[model samples]
Target: MDTQTLKHLNEAQREALEVAEASRETEWTSPSFVAELFMGKIRTNLIFPYPEQSPEDRQIGDEFMKQLESFLKCNLDPDEVDRTGILPPEIIEGLTRLGCWGMKIPKEYGGLGLSQINYNRAIALVASYCGSTAVWLSAHQSIGVPQPLKLFGTAEQKKKYFPKFAQGAISAFALTEPDVGSDPAKMTCVAVPSADRKTWTINGTKLWCTNGLIADVLVVMAQTPSKIVHGKEKKQITAFIVEKGTPGIQYPHRCDFMGIRAIQNGVIEFKNVVVPAENILWGEGLGLKLALITLNTGRLTLPAACGGMSKQALRISRLWGKEREQWGAPIAQHEAGAVKLSHMAANVFAMEAMTYYASALVDRGGSDIRLEAAMAKLFCSEAAWKIIDDLVQLRGGRGFETASSLRQRGEKGYAVERMMRDSRINRIIEGTTEIQHLFIAREALDYHMKLVGAFINSQSSFSEKWKSFWKCAFFYPKWYLGLWCSFDWMKSYAGYRPLSSEIRFVGKNSKKLSRTIFHLLLKFGPKLESHQMVLARVVEIGTELFAMACSCSKAISLIRNNPSDLSPVELAKIFCKQSQIRIQHYYDALKKNTDPEDRTLSKKVMNQAFSWMEQGIIPDDGAGFQKNSETTVPLEEKRRYSV
Candidate 1:
């Protein structure tokens, strides 16, 4: 499949492919350790003194945060909206008035034209207050019509759409279908071109289209007729900007979820919906690329939301841990509870570091950040889930109750339940955690794939094969030797000011990680993808390494700028120490683990070989298990007597 894909590329397309390949290669050869880390290659470099926000940018962020705070306080009641399962029209209007819709659009389009960091900050601020509002805002600009239009729309198209988008017109991204989630290759939606080629009629149903019910515009992807590529028929997907209320466009049903209830998500159907030729984005057959590019940055929103949720959890946990007493003292005094709080704080610090670093990379704009963005989304979402769960455990009974219910009972309420529900969706949306692991693993093995590709190509001459062999011979030994022997000089290349001993230890292990990855790639070759467990562990190691690097760099920057405050530095050190331990565990598991036996057991179970275990047990009926006692205490009575 890869061979065929590579064979059909034209010069320009091949150049683009080469550019991507070269960029991945540069990560290892260049001085950016973070970039190299994404490729599973750890080279010491000055990649992180932590990016600093310009004063002007800082001021803009401060002003926006201030305005957003006032706006949320005055116009939004998250608890009320959560109960109603709808965002009030007035709140949407308020967001529009606050320029939330235009936050990502450029200034020339009558929008805020905020930098990526500022944009993410804005998302975090709004998300902290209301998940639904954040979804609405992010859906509008992050992956919606505006983003693709900004990236690929013609000047005329921009002129036509930018103004409306700036004026608070809601937009949605419609890519997922009932059958399609991560794989667009399975898309069944069709866009048939008119005989004259002046228009195209789209017919499809998009499932879980966020903001679909309320969107004024939607960017939809559909399978166009196949185009011949190098004499072989190939599937072609196209993206179109379809205006709302277009002929045959209908919202057949509104979808509800476990979380983010205020979002106007639904199934959107386009039956014979005619879109003009000019509506096509970039060009025909570029839909997949456009979608991927949109998502590269679009995924950042999830991490920002994760960061926000973490902050909220940390604050709530700290207060509850101090105030809530157990055994004649604050629960926080207990070792178990104190450990959870510490982990929460450390993970939040790491999450913030990673999210901001990725955002800064986007704002910097010279390098490709597809890997960084995915890692951020993957790590932050999982971290936020664990952190929120800890918060729930910390609050005990109060965390299980809805905020409104607690408020009605005259107790200070925390939205831990709601936040937990909200955090779960982040793992599934944008990309599932499983999907992200696969994506990260694929990317991390780019160099190995290229090397293997050279050897496998049937078209390569004997001389070329010999050269490739020599290249590998030179590269592998040098790479491994560098990792082993370069420890003495690694610190000099460790970017900016000297790192603390703990951080230096992290750097040393990162080199070991890269060497281990290289050995795995050599051992597995093309069959490595089948070993999903090992691939997943490799991704885990890389993610932790990157997180540790970001945390340490951020701490160093904070300490340098504010020497008087060492608390942040300490937190960062703790996070890095924990990350280092995790990295070692993952690497060790990769070397010696029961994953193969686990896979065997899983396969046997799935194949129904465990029937003997269930032989005497009756299958569970549709009805769930009942309590031993028939009578259940009323909520009022329980609340009256519960601790």
Candidate 2:
């Protein structure tokens, strides 16, 4: 969109863009345009920041969990749990009683109307207790029912359907058919309209429907017509509310899954099932958008549950590592075991932080976040897989064998296997990882171009001069290429050189000399984490850095003077340092691959950290570290207070 930004492309960026535009020829799995520009590398220097939630939000999330724990303790009869599958009927009833299904439903519709933050916290708790139960709850409220209503349902539709969700009445979303899995465009579930256009006859089988076997209401997507319109084919997609006992609706029995077995998943054949026109959600042609919205929300939320599951596995691994000694000291003290623990901690923390950040953004309701959500989903899901694998390895022989009935080998194995299967589904479901890359590339390019265009537009007085400079600058193509290549190269090279360069730029261009304080903060970020203050300051620095970058681009548009003006340049310099410090803090908090002691401490602490997580304790809280007499907050509650 911004042509001036286009002019800023270094050679590597251009090359990457070229490669990405040609990605289809390479099975659409090549390195992304952004990757190519940044030398096919990721900058570990940049940290994604977790939401700086207010006390009210934290209290809300915490209080919600306290309520859950209370409900689980008071209402749920532990004896009702199926020891084999361990999915308690009382747990379901308790969730139903707690109004869990009404979490995201609007208050106007008789729901608690919790925000995204509350929803994630609840899901994490469920996932930690029982991954299957978590899946069951999330799959129903998240993917199965209210989502479609949110996207396509009319005001009347919302009024009618949303109220039912508060009752915890189960529903299933049917999209993946027997013949088609990821490709909804290829779906053959046809809903033919009646002669009077008042009703539609649905005919098709929906495969892999979670809660499909017993759902009281089903929201099914069907393709009614496919024909070319305005030189583009119009694919008529429609959704209908098919009650469980609809005349032509037939369940083909439960399709047993490897994991999440307690929650029934099955296929349903719609043999000329008849439904009223009033049931058509938001009318024809809106089904796909509704489905996409539902899927994207699920893609983002599912990973949060995965993060919890991974957290549980990591905790179990560390617990075993500490208790299960072999040869000499605890096996966890062994180097190999320690490495596994460290890697797991790093991944768990990163995924947790990332998921929260993404969720917060979604809650903010400003940014499109399609790309952000997809990236978070991709990273979090993949991280969960690796974390679980390492957990299994850390457990050794006992981990492989069935232990307690609650944590039996068959159940754990099936759950893990199911998670793996479901994990792959996320990659392909909303938009494949490859498709995500395309979106990421487009967004990055769009961002870059916007900056460039601003740079050009704001320089109206010197436009001719800049044009002349550019013409001569491009004459030496190699030099221009090298300039672009530098951005790519810097991504892979994590040394202080890039920071130093930014520092130099700031020092030269900064208007107020005091701005250098921010630059100094950025310079010490990596070192500070290496120091004892790894948990707090680093997060601040990462946040500063991201804020600085974003602010600098904004300043360029807002400021009148050009970069050539010393005052303008100085202002930009000051902003850059402030922003960089903020941005760098995010990465600093990532539970990184740090010193041996920090890593060890992080694992032990995070284990206890997780225990109190649903209770609202953060990782830096004292459960991982020793009690400090000097601090006002108890060691157990330091992280909770810090936020």
Pairs of residues clashing in candidate 1: 46-495
Tell me how many clashing residue pairs each candidate has. 1, 37
lDDT of 1 by residue, 280-332 (tens): 99998888778877888889988998899889999999999999998988998
Where in model 2 is the C-alpha error above 4 Å?
A: 1-50, 73-89, 405-643
Candidate 1 worst ten-residue window by lDDT: 17-26
Candidate 1 error regions (>4 Å): 1-32, 38-46, 457-467, 487-490, 493-498, 611-643
Compared with the true structure, model 1 gives a TM-score of 0.89
Task: Assess the local accuracy of residue 460 in candidate 2 as a C-alpha lDDT between 0 and 100.
Answer: 40
Highest TM-score: give the candidate number. Answer: 1
